[model samples]
Target: MLSWRRSTSATAPGSSLAYGCADFLGGPGARKAHVLRTVMVAAPAGLAVELLLWPVLGASFSGAPLGWGAASGAASAAAFALLHRTLAIGPMNVLSPVTALVSAALPVGVALLHGEHLGAAGLVGLPLALVAVVQVGAGHGAGVARPSRTALLLAFGAGTAIALQLIFLHQAPSDSGVAPLITGRAVSSAVTLAAAGQMHRRLGAERPAYAMSAAASVLDSLANLLFLLAARNGDLTVVAVITALYPAGAVLLARGVLAERVHRGRLIGLGTAAVAVSLLALT
Candidate 1:
């Protein structure tokens, strides 16, 4: 059984935490001040972090890495857009699980096809983890709309883009360091800004929570960095599945900081997640 691979320095768990914090900080602001407007701040904020780290990390902007970075950037931007649109059309509880499933399942399938195996512990833990991700996102409010075909389509699209972003970032060469992220973040920032400009009227006087957006972006950047490192050192299937449990982190954070009520389903999810992580650690 794959209990969190100690060999990877718990990078997957670190990624999950960072991702959860990013979502927690970003989610409210996006919902309140238009997703695109919040993203305008988030994207640039991430770019600034990457720019600062690029030189220290020893960036080498080669063709393949740059291409992958750009692709990842475009995919991330698409994911943000599609995710918000899908949520607007449907409930988060109804649509989020689908997106989360696709994002994890696709990468797991690809990793398996490429000859990565999870062994016994991983086999036991992975399913539980995936289930935990869905359960953790279960809601007491919002997500009241019945999921229609359009919402399903958008959810699937967003998930696909999210998967692609991860895959693209992982595909960058080892020596590429954080250079690819710099390129990727810059591209996403430019695209987000342009979209925000086009939809400025939608923003009206609803200014984004700049500090929260920037904090979220920094957390997201850290998560991506950790994910890339974990993917490089561990089986993609294991790392991706583990990292996808990020929703649990967000839920707990909301409960603690915002005093949001946790549903019974999510409490069970947290319990299951603890079990899953314990099992995966043996791997």
Candidate 2:
């Protein structure tokens, strides 16, 4: 059910025709619609795939790890809603990386609290990650409006939910496999997506809106699969860090195809994030 294909914008062959067509037919609104559809489709599909992969943990379905994951996802969605309204920041540019950073840090901190000795490499990655986060945040400030106090707290709450979700994923029985974990993700995502649909209805849905959500949903599903696989098989901290780099993907796509100009600082921060990804993965 993966509809997303890898296509480059600048250097890829057969770009001129598509670019001309999009320029002729798909304007800014078309792009916005694309983004919205991507969200709706990818978010739900991603969750479903994750749940399908993770075996349910605990006896009762609601008592399983998926349940808690669903809860965490709901919390995250709420946080997103708050941000969309109050902060006016877009999802990929601001929300995705921020959540990824918090999710990565949380598990590491939790592991330490549980008396797990982090490798020296992990210890080193921590401060570098912190610096990377600050840089990303500073970069985001250029295009997006500053979050108000309420929006900031709510956004933090979203990050907390994601962090807790990862922590719980790590805490879940290893034998639980992919079914339960992916199920949890699916449930959470379903709730969030349904809510988003409602919000869109209220906000007014247009052609571009539908397309963007559809695209996001597809991307989200793919990301979800990658993250779930990474989490189940790899170190949670490392997995979280790598997945957090998704924003860079979005930014690059925007710049390349959409021709959206990024602030230099944001570009630098994203570059810093890329370095952090390399360092975290190696460690």
Candidate 1 on 38-147: residue-level lDDT in tens?
87778778888878776566677989889999999999989988988887787778788888888888888888898887779989999998898788766765366578
- The numbered model that scores best in lDDT is 1
Error of 1 at 171 (Å): 0.9
TM-score (C-alpha, index-matched) for candidate 1: 0.92
* Candidate 2 wrong stretches, greater than 4 Å: 1-44, 47-63, 89-103, 140-147, 189-211
Q: What is the C-alpha RMSD of each candidate to the true structure, in Å?
A: 3.7, 8.3
The global C-alpha lDDT for each of the candidates, from Candidate 1 onward, is 0.83, 0.50
For residues 1-283, could you state the per-residue lDDT of candidate 2 as single tens digits? Answer: 3221222211111221222222223234345442344346546555654455334322224456555555546554564455344334443345444555665577667766767544676567656665565455444454364445555555666667656655655555444445444555556567766666766755345445444444444444444434444555556655554444444554556678779787877677677765665555555
Where does the lowest 10-residue lDDT sum fall in candidate 1?
1-10
Count of backbone clashes, every candidate in sequence: 13, 42
Task: lDDT for model 1, please.
Answer: 0.83
